[model samples]
Target: MKTVFSPLHAGHSGNVELIAGAIVPAFEKPSRAEFIRARVESEKLGPILPPEIHDLAAARKVHASDYIDFLPTVWPLWEASGRSGSAIPFTWPTRGLRGDVRPNGIDALLGFYSFDGGATFVKGTWDAIKSSYDVALTAAALVKAGEPSAFALCRPPGHHAGAAFMGGYCFINNAAVAAQWFRDHGAGRVSILDVDYHHGNGTQEIFYRRGDVQVLNLHGDPMTEYPFFLGHADERGEGDGEGFNDNYPMPFGTGWDAWNASLEDACTRLSAYAPDVVVVSLGVDTFEKDPISQFKLKTGDYPRIGRRIARLGLPTLFVMEGGYAVEEIGINAVGVLTGFEDR
Candidate 1:
């Protein structure tokens, strides 16, 4: 598997998130991608390549144009507003609020465009976010060009970002952008299998009304997890996408046995769908040691997850998502790629 990476991710460092009712260092830090790249190198997984430059048009296919314009200017706007720290949103237009009105102020726009305060904007965040999107597109291009599989080592992981809102430490939904790229490039169907510990609410929302992409997510149940609004079992889909979305909301402390069972079922559905390509939102936060996530997956189990996906025998793209166990992230994330190749 070829790995797509970028040093620009380092620029997006020094950001923070609201965790446990306190401002803390962001778990989705630069070191997470560095460790994964180091492991890919040490394991001789494959050639590590810099991402190709892709125009914003590709991203605009999955994300709203207004949202895209807003992201790049967030830091400048915040700084112009006399803010000194990383830009974080504190208010939201919730239920009964005027969701249709656009707020002009940067502070109000931040909350208007985001579901939570997780996606903090730093001086280099826009560049890093674009680089991550480029990385994903580059890897997806490889698979579309006939490569069996490729790993996009994206940082500021993107599973939680929607078309118009950013949260869960994600800006642009990298996996969703790649999936849309595939469809636009002649793929008849694409399937996104998100193995992140948190539900891929963003991906699901993007494809909820479309039928070209099928989404499957396995994660901590929304009732007891972060982004506690979506990922329910009953959010099957709407309109043309009916019955195309699936969610396995595993409870806290879910072990490999139960998790793998869910994977099996998802794979079976993928087989039935017979998608032209598969995109795995490869998140290793399910690791027992992950600080912010709950699950019991061990490092050894990651390879098995990859092997099972390999059994599908379709071209695959592994887009990086959530995984904050900084020390073990490399082993767990690369284990999946290694297993797929070995299988």
Candidate 2:
């Protein structure tokens, strides 16, 4: 498998995320990608390559024009208001407020486009985010060209970004973008399996009404997780998308034994869908030692997780999402690929 990486991810670092109601430290950081890359090198999983640059048109396919406009330029606009640092959303457009009207000011636009307050942008955030999308697209192109699998080690992890909103430490939804890319090329059904500790709320919202892309997620139940809005098992896809989406929201303290059971069920569901490809929103935050995540998946369990996904026998694209225990991120993430290779 080829690993597509962008060192530009280092630029989007630094910002306090509004996690658990208080802005402490951000669980998503640059070191997370670095550690994973190191393990890939040490393990000699495969060759590492820089991502090919992709046009903004690819992103435009999945993002709202205004929302896409807001993320890359909002920081510069916000700083022009005499704010001397990274731009974080302090307000959001909610019910009883006019969300349809575009806000002329950066602060207002920030509130209008962002669903949550976590996506803070720094000076170099645009370049880094642009590269992150490119990395995912490069990985997608590889899969489209017949590679059995590829790893898109994206940063500013993207499962929480939707068509018009950026939240949950995401600006552009990489998995959604790649999945859409696959659909655009030739794939009939592009199935996204989000195994991140948090359900891919943004990914779900993006494809919730469509049938071409089937979305499934196994995450900490929203009743106790970070993005506390969606991820319930009942929120299946609507209209043409009905019965195409599945969610396995597990309880806290859930370990591999229980989590693997959910995974098996998900595999069974996918077998019926018979999609042309599989995209794994690979987040290892469920590791027992993960600082921000609960559930008791020991480090050793990650390999087994990988092997199980590979058992599906579909072309796979692994896109990085969340995992706070930076130390073990590399091994645990690589363990999935290792398991796939071994199997």
Candidate 3:
């Protein structure tokens, strides 16, 4: 598998995030990608290439233009508002509040565009955000050009971002963008399998009303996890997408036995769908040591996950997502790739 990466991800590092009612150092740091890249190198997984430049129009296909415009200007607007720290949202328009109105104040706009305060905007955030998008697209392009599989080492992981809102340390939904790029180019059907510990609420929402792309996710149940709103078994797609979206909401202490069972079921469904390509939102946070996630997957189990996906025998794209056990992230994430290659 050829891996696409970017050093620009180092630019979006934030100092703090509010977790468990207390501020702490951001877990989604640049080192996460570095470790994964280092492992890919040490393992001789494949060639590591820089991302190709893609037009902003490609991103607009999956994200709203207004949201895209708002992201790049966040830091400048925050600094202009006399803020000294990283730009974070404190208030959100919820329940009965008007969601359609766009506020002019930087503080209000931040909340308007974000679901939570986790995705901070630093001086280099925009550059990193765009680079991450480029990385995903470049890897997707490789698969489109006939490569069987590729890894997009995206940072500021994108599973939580939606078309109009940003959260969960994600700005643009890289996996969603790549899936859309595939459809727009030539693919008849594309399926996204998000294996992140957290539910891929963004990817599901992006494709919930469409039938061309199928979205399946396995994650911590929403009742007891971060992004604790969606990701239930009942969130079947609407309209043309009905019965196309699937979510396996595993409980907190889920082990590899239960998790792999869910993967087997999802792969069976993918076989039925027979998409032209598959996009795996590869997140190893399910590892037992992951700080913010719950699950009991071990390092040795990752390769099995890869081998199972490989059994499908379809072109695949592995886009990096969350995995905060920075020390072991590489072994677990790359284990999936190596397992697939071995298959």
TM-score of each: 0.99, 0.98, 0.99
- The C-alpha stretches of model 1 lying farther than 4 A from their native spots are none
Report the C-alpha lDDT of model 3 over 216-297, residue by residue, as the tens digit: 9999999999889999999989999998999999999999999999999999999999999999999999999999989999
What lDDT score is found at residue 283 in candidate 3? 96
Ranking by lDDT: 1, 3, 2
Report the C-alpha lDDT of model 1 over 118-232, residue by residue, as the tens digit: 9998999999999999999999999989999999999878999999999999999999999999999999999999999999999999999988899999999999998899999
Scored by lDDT, the top model is 1
Sorted on TM-score, highest at the top, how do the candidates line up? 1, 3, 2
Q: In angstroms, give how far residue 96 of model 2 lies from its true place.
A: 1.9
10 residues in a row with least lDDT, candidate 1 = 18-27
Q: In model 2, where do residues sit more than 4 Å from their true spots?
A: none
Clashing pairs in 2: none
Residue 208 of model 1, lDDT score: 98
